[model samples]
Target: MAIATPQQDTPPSELAIEARGLVKRFDATLAVDGVDLTVRRGSITGILGPNGAGKTTTLRMLLGIIDPDEGTRRVLGHENPRDVARLIGYLPEERGLYPAMKAVEAIAFMGALRGLPLAEGRKRGRALLEDHGLGEAADRQIRHLSKGMAQIVQLLGTLVHDPQLVILDEPFSGLDAINQGKLEVLIRGLADRGVTVIFSTHVIAHAERLCESIAIIAGGRVPFAGRVDEARDRIPAQVRLETSAHDGPWRAALPDTARQVGQFWFFPLPETGVEPLLRALIDGEAGIQSLSIERAGLHDAFVAIAGEAAAARLVTSDAGEEG
Candidate 1:
């Protein structure tokens, strides 16, 4: 199989995927409300939201698997997704593989379905298996492989065509830490090769680490869409202090943003250094146990944008699934 080539003829537009006021309805329930998203060519972007937050629906619409009731979309520079279907690769959240099929055979079959000849597909599949550290398992049946192996095989099948754009839905749902890390590396490799990647994940950490930009959807609507740094900037820095003196004159030195959290007092650090506060606390004879400043992360940004309840729900759900 020929290596999937980077898009040689660049689209006049810089975007790989763009949607305007995309809306999808399931019966009377609006799965995706009016949402706008744009993924730049060769950039890795993430669609982040909790379960049932319309991420899957939005992806489907963008891929033309499902049409939106309202709005418009263009994929890979084509007005219609089918026009460039061969240029796109998709890995759905639901995992499936032919249990009786050999790993190499399975991957090759997928490539063949996407227009690659069986012989070439098989050749490429073998090489890919070796590259992915599954060379010994190439001839083994899918049913004999571990869940992680099967998952990687399925994902590789999605990549067989060497698509210009890869859209993955909850790609990290069931993988353990090691396999998850491997997948992250694979995603970055794709981006390094100039492939546009749009992945939807409930896990924000994956997006934080892998994406250049993100579209944050909540309640079926996108509340934020921009670079990761922009999102992080939406929330202020945090300061955590553990002090033996919980009250008195030391309290006066504390910023108005300060709040007690068990034995620690948490607050948003002002733009100025904490030196003044430290001096004030010491002058007031306050016994400081520990003090640390933390830069705001995606999780903190998400909470600030989507509210604590929604963020907490996603964290709880992710923990349960991982456990």
Candidate 2:
């Protein structure tokens, strides 16, 4: 189906979701603590963290799937998110589909739960399937489809109701590279149509590529939240230098933080700038074979903000559904 593009009547700066000091606990364990997040209307925002970082818990609290032990949230102007649940679409990390149901029926059923009439839902579902290259699979049973195809069906269901705000938890978890790329495109398309998209993922690359703003969570606490550029700015740019002389007085010009890896020297650009270092290298007769200043990327920023230990868990399997 050609998703209807909502009129862009809302200001870009208008808040779609505002969550303050959200806290959730299970037994004696704190899953989410003191998370404050904001999403601008018509923007793609990401909740980024490693496995077991409470990303899912925070999202659930925001959606009113589970009440926060403390704090408050406003979703699409409703102080209680449940009051506006019909306008929000959520795809949980744990995906499910009825084995006996046809792909189209599954999508329609999901839409019906969100208030779309079954007949209308089925019509939209078929159109969506055809639009997404799943037309041939529309009549196939969920049990017969490949894992990737089934996941696509669930994703299509998430949008069948054309929700104004969409929340996805680790939407990329099990997909291969090809499907992951396709999903990314779909997400961008939603934002283009003026839908507010908020997704949680441990993958920094996805956030770096798709999210205008991000919240970095770790150990049940949010360490950073804002525009991607602002998060990257938390760390200084890095300098990668390769000199003809591997060792010389020129090395003295390099900061104490500099480390030699292979033939390259890596360090944060000194506060005084690279001019002084370049001059010292030239005067000291250290042949400057190559020099490059690299801006800190999302991965670097994540490591800096969440600590190396937390960053190490990014690519690991999620600890539980709440991760």
Candidate 3:
């Protein structure tokens, strides 16, 4: 409930997390392969991947919840992540709350696990509920609260200890559109207050909207990691042109990669530029009805980096999920 103001004294280049060559295996199945990641202090980073892409395993390794079979990691300057556990908060994909526990009690319980005093945790829990418009539900049992309310309570619990770094796994899994938006605002607010955040999600849109940087993983291997803009730059911009004339001399100006669909023509923007193409269209009387250029989105970049098959799997997996 007490959010820290953005710190002017913190260095811009400080690293919050650094991991390299992380590997984890479960029985004969390799859950994570040699992976490297870096997170800047006070930044929101997303581990973007489809279902079964080793996202959870990777997060667990970084959090010291599960030891890596190989590689090294440092969290908030400590070589052993667990050494700084008290400074970190984690919300696992699996949600758990005692049905009989009051909302405030549930939050206080979580904070107590991280070493907060019971009374202090209770005070903060009630304040958090009141701050987030759930003050009326503070005294209600968890079982009596709606699913969305319970989730918000758990999220507040994650922050009750005022952790410097927060790691969330599929935090948006079961929320509806409005709740999802609220979560996005909450995450942004955390980053604004200088709390480092790293979250994993199969959905690309959330990562695109919330993360300045992201790591794209598929089949336990990272295909890309860096700024979201860098990932989008992997592919060229696309051009969509609609013409009144189906056949004309301007057709010669179109790239060989262009494809026709109904009244629309689509292709990657030419290397030279759109000016030459526009001139050709106008001079040759191609009767251009409409033209637009669009940069590749994170979704298109995902398809480019992870391949169409993996992208298809991501779409199918997301479709089956309630959120």
Candidate 4:
């Protein structure tokens, strides 16, 4: 195991996951070339990437499921994960509960593996199921629950020990919308208790709303990582506006900051620009029935900083030729 930090003298309120230049290789191919990430002690950190972008590989290394070929990682400030896993919980991409086992028993077993007492683990397991709205499902066999219910069971299993840091990889795959919302609330609640939370998901919009910080992995590397709002500002916020009128003078009458959206003219104004823009729009009768300000986001920033063509190069790269 490689440790980025030798010791944890700092307050435990610091970062939960600190990785620098993490790399993993299988055979001649580099599954994860280089990536740096951090999960703050009480915040939800999101890792965004498409299906073959090495998100899972990076996560596996971070969780100590597999050692990286090169680079350093620390979870809950412990380099030796067997010791740290006592406080660091991981929910793998695949649901690992045994379908033949009762929900309560499966959760208890998972917790006991982390060194929790069996009776305490079972008690906590039942309570967690109730907290997650599945109190009645505790005695039911895993295979008898609905897909969504099973997911909740697995999640409760992940939390039975009340670990301080939780890492979830694609934990929202089969849930319906309502279940997704519940999960979001649960994640936020965990963070509220000062549990550093990190998860990978392709559901960009939902993650965008919940995660204040995000890391974008593209082609085995991190192309973007920062505050979501600041990341958005990096993308060019220019849009060409379109209008139904074939030839409208509103383009010229608009403020100097205006750019084009489609046929309509778009303009970025000062903090005071709102009133003047509306005034100008109404005055010129731009026939502007619709007006929207386009802002950059994780989506636009991903496409801009790392262009689609750049991702294509990585996709066609020999690294994942077999995937």
lDDT (0-100) at residue 116 of candidate 3? 97
Every candidate's lDDT? 0.85, 0.87, 0.88, 0.75
**Candidate 3: misplaced stretches above 4 Å?**
1-13, 316-323
**Candidate 4 residue-wise lDDT, 1-323, digit = tens:** 22222223435448777788888988988889878776778888888777778889998998888998887777777875556878978889888788899999989998998888989989999889888778898899998999888888888888889898898998777777678778889998998898888998766665677897888777788877776776678855544445555445545555576655456665554355456656765566566666666776666676776677543433221123211
Please, what are the lDDT tens digits per residue for candidate 1 over residues 74-158? Answer: 8877879988888888899988889999999999998887788888888999999999999999999999999989999999999
> TM-score ranking from best to worst?
3, 2, 1, 4
Error of 2 at 209 (Å): 1.5
Q: Which 10 consecutive residues of model 3 have the lowest summed lDDT?
A: 1-10
Task: Rank candidates, lDDT, best first.
Answer: 3, 2, 1, 4
Error of 4 at 62 (Å): 1.2
TM-score of each model, in listed order:
0.88, 0.90, 0.93, 0.82
lDDT of 3 by residue, 119-183 (tens): 99999999999988999999999999888889999999999999999999999989877778789
**Model 3 clash tally?**
0
For candidate 3, the TM-score is 0.93
- Against the true structure, candidate 3 has what lDDT? 0.88
Model 2 agreement with the true structure over 15-53: per-residue lDDT tens digits: 898777888999999898888887888899999998789
TM-score (C-alpha, index-matched) for candidate 1: 0.88
RMSD of each: 5.8, 6.1, 5.4, 6.1
Model 4, which residues run further than 4 Å from truth? Answer: 1-13, 238-249, 253-290, 309-323
